[model samples]
Target chain A: MTSETPIIVLVRPQLGENIGKCARAMLNFGLTELRMVAPRDGWPNPSAGPAAAGADSVLDQAKIYDTTAEAVADCSHVYATTVRLREDTKRVVTPEEAATEVFNQAGRSAFLFGREASGLDVQDVAMANAILTVPINPEFGSLNLAQAVILCAYEWSKTQSLSQPTLTEQLPPAPQQDLDGLIGHLEAMLEPKGYFLPDSRADATRRTLRNVLTKPGWNHLEVRTLRGVLSTLAKRDRK
Target chain B: MTSETPIIVLVRPQLGENIGKCARAMLNFGLTELRMVAPRDGWPNPSAGPAAAGADSVLDQAKIYDTTAEAVADCSHVYATTVRLREDTKRVVTPEEAATEVFNQAGRSAFLFGREASGLDVQDVAMANAILTVPINPEFGSLNLAQAVILCAYEWSKTQSLSQPTLTEQLPPAPQQDLDGLIGHLEAMLEPKGYFLPDSRADATRRTLRNVLTKPGWNHLEVRTLRGVLSTLAKRDRK
Candidate 1:
């Protein structure tokens, strides 16, 4: 479990049993860390025991917090689950892709699920570095709290290696350049070419482009090819 | 839109916003009937108006119910989504399989998602002839409320014909033992055989057996034929 283990933070969960069941799901994928933020019911809830089935240990050791930020404060990375799409939201990942990144990151990670009623308010979603959404039907896309966690956990479990350290660690970072630096170079090339109009929107567009490319777990070869394409476009515009 | 159109049932949803969002998901798949079982904030909730974005019709025509049974009373079939698995729970169908079954039934159907954290209680699941579970990772399987409904709605939408349906008045129910009955019969048959012995605890064996059969979509005739073979063996044992 070591570095691969994830901390599950649930904000304002309305039901004690859901907290318990979330614990059960985490155990299924060999994850244990649990954090609760301002849960509707008091912690150490008796209702959680039966619902957790045999995963009571997770409930026993769960940490409590007053805010979403506090729940994930110790983690190096955080992913917020949301059903509705926000136009201004940056760094959105489909649940499958987020799992890969979560497994690859070197430090502790946390995934947050909000209350049953309103879900995570925009404020909660904004707190996270990334937004994680399941590719659900545009119509009727309401998912229960525990179900969302299971999908993420399922994806993470799939990427786990048996003999190898972890799927994420196997690749390591490219010696030549990191994802952010390469993205920055590409955006610089595009900026002069009017690839993204309006100075105010340039950063957002570049970030969106970078977010899309990063989803595939790009390598040196792919990044170089992308950079080359940007260079060619830049030269043609200048001519 | 035929039985192929999956119905969305919000069981005792406390918040009107969730009910509205759930209706929006249904509308995404061209489903319109929104059944609410004892909503906490009452129907035509003002909070739901904005959260639904542009799905006011779903709230406008929403149907309210006193209980889950009442919510699904008109439908020929029902499915409940639960967070944790119970021993006596009906056979679990993945969202995809449930979509296919809905198409086959050629009858009105309801898929129930319960209150945020508690999920569907055992009685709730039993009411539905079957339990529908989204294929989540075994570990950390918490699904946000709207997201769960979205997945089922998405799968249900996929099986639909994009073209406008020619007016067909009625269709026959496909002949098959529903998954719940077939699995029960299979478990009973296995019990007499050494497949599940005094040493192998019936509950564990039952869960394992259900898990195996639940993966692939089994039609009614195929399930009946398998049960026939089991019945024949049981006959010999009785002699």
Candidate 2:
């Protein structure tokens, strides 16, 4: 859950031209935060300058990261954009749904987009709490990166002033790092007890667990309580 | 008054690349009809092909006109797209209002866009029944030709059934009884640890915890997962 204007995170984006176009698209809809996870041509590319079409501020201020996880660590609500819905338990939300949620909820939200050739990897998708899918023309659904970014940005921009006046009284969900700590604690405990046995299914089991935990959108206080619960149970056993 | 799909008219557009981009943008939102009035480089421009990307169909079927008046000769409701509101009697409508009007009224509607450097001329403004403007960021309102075209196209697409499916997948919040059971389980576990020992404040602390837990409205699956987690921890302690 998040009330902050969502940031755009491009994961392993390929072209400098597309990156420039993305920056332009984002700025067009009043979005400024641009996080890139390992660009193919590297940052500060000459091709980007010409294509940005005067959105250099977004590009100039763009932050780069080595991995998707690190990029979204501060975000509380992370949305992964996918062309086609994968067979997963994660909830699928439209651009409008996501836009509305951002305004009414309480934490920082980030949208994730994969590279040019293929969309986000299975691992990257697992990292996101939900999937953001744009329903386009079934006959000819060909939305490029900039186009996709524009739609989400446009939807979000629409809600800035007009969002429901009533804000949720609930606390915002814990940041990604906090959730990671909780998940890590659970994994550590479950690991020695063979909860992740048959190493082949470990990755999938972990992803399923993540999807289940993420669905609750637990607040920091709740996360802390759960963490304390774990410690208490563990300490009792140790004694 | 127009109920038919709105047609896009590019008035004396200067660049073929921009024309191609407009075509791509239009096709993205399921808008197919594109009209160009006196393109600078002439018809069948080479640069347009690459920029159109996969929207060749829109370009192939595009109608060319000698003037803006001739372009909308067959249309009844004409809209002039301008960067600024003209000081005239014309009713200024947002892209969304224009889109809603397009679906509600009767007769053919056409949206007119001007050249790359300069927008629609006074004569072109006079031809329209209303002016369609996108309210963007005042600080940086530099929307390119294709970007402008896409925003209008995207708004128009919203009225159609194209976006109906993307909003149906999210599960509803779980029932109240499930929430109570999960809260009870957590409280029972925490009780042994003296979490609610102070008799006077115990009720208030429990209420706070309940409020935090209830805020998420976790679905049955999530509640069940929490129950399993509590059981797992408690069973471990006993072992």
Candidate 3:
């Protein structure tokens, strides 16, 4: 279970309430390990105890430390969560990507969210191999600490697949007609230009073009871009 | 901005920490209103203070009610988050779809997630207009309540205009329209054979053909297959 569960660390948490909430988020995502560093309010703070809700077990058993380093000392992998982007950080990951890494860890991994107001100091962020950032609207991106934990926990939970899903949930969206139209346009323009002529050879050309576009998911913008390229090429052939 | 916020109602929340964390997730998404229904330990539990960390403001302002309906009384819409799919309840929605509703809401809406262990009873889900469920791996879909809040938050965040996303964040392209042309070509062939001409006027036939091919988000493979069909038809026509 330790392999799957990430050890959640709070470095210099200034509030008891935040710690309690973080613990709650941890429990929500199947993570039970809680570690704290230099909490402002002393452990067993009455505020934190009741705030933990059903996650009291995590709060009760939470391991406290004097520093971020000490709290994550036992962790094989550590991630620091922050909203601010830094110039020098090594691995910058979205919460989902970070969770993917945590899911892959061989031993105990720790996800650290800093204090309430100031957030994790740059020095503390450097302690972990990776930094996890939530993509928020830059205009109003002040994500609270517990919010960060919840996002992290949510991504982790998705990987676990805890509930049965309906048929729509199981299947991806069906493909549409726009793609075929564009390809047909390209082929129509190309057929007379010798791009694909022999009736049998046309099949191979069409398959090769299809293979190139279908591997990764595409959206309207990319489709437009590809159409532009094809139109340019087709025009050149006309010339 | 209660209008844009998703209401987080905890039903019989057993611990202060869990409630605090839930509050944390709400605030992160700019959701501040919280309602608790008969928390086992009590409202304004002291333990929640420290656990709330930076989200103390959310905890400080939390409201407590006697029932789920009371908690959602002021909201225009509500979605209950549940792990179990009860046999009797109807109107279930995936969390992603729920986020879409919250984003589109003309007024305030609430997304309710239940407590740990036993999820929201069927009666609770029946109270809401829709039931919100997350699609997990199924093998391990049991998500903690706070984690559910986080996932909702993440999906909502994606809709936010958070600067231009990196190229990698781009979704797959919808299939182009070349396939529709192929379908049209085939329909034309069938029309000559009286397959759809006499009984179906050509203009009416064309409309039905277009309707059959039109889909919301088609991808590259789909268009290619249509083109392949056209190619086969061309080969046969040549023979």
Best by TM-score: 2
Model 2 Cα lDDT, one tens digit per residue, B175-206: 99999998898887777777676889899879
| DockQ-derived CAPRI band for the predicted complex in model 2 | acceptable
lDDT of 3 by residue, B1-239 (tens): 22265667888888888787777666666666777888889878987877565678778788888887567655555677876565422356777678776666544577776768787854456455557776543333445677677677768766554343223232222322343354556665455445443564655445434323332223445556546544543342221
Docking class of 3: incorrect
TM-scores, all models, native as reference: 0.44, 0.86, 0.49
- The candidate, 1 or 2, that scores higher on DockQ is 2
Q: Model 1: how large is the Cα RMSD against the reference?
A: 23.6
lDDT of 3 by residue, A1-239 (tens): 54367777888888787777777766755667788888888777778865576678888898888888888887788888889788873788888788788777687778888889888888788888888889864544556677678677767766665534543322232254656766677666556555565778878877876654454233444455446544443332111
Write candidate 1's Cα lDDT for B97-145 as tens digits: 8889998886788899888767776667878888887655455565646
Candidate 3 stretches greater than 4 Å from native:
A1-3, A162-239, B1-85, B89-93, B97-130, B134-150, B159-239
TM-score of 1: 0.44
- Provide fnat values for all models in the order shown: 0.08, 0.37, 0.14
Q: Write the per-residue lDDT of candidate 2 for residues A143-233, one digit (tens) a residue.
A: 7898889889888888986846746787778898888898899878777666565899989778767777776678888899778766755
- Tell me the lDDT of model 1 at A166: 50
TM-score of 2: 0.86
Candidate 2 at residue B207, lDDT? 89
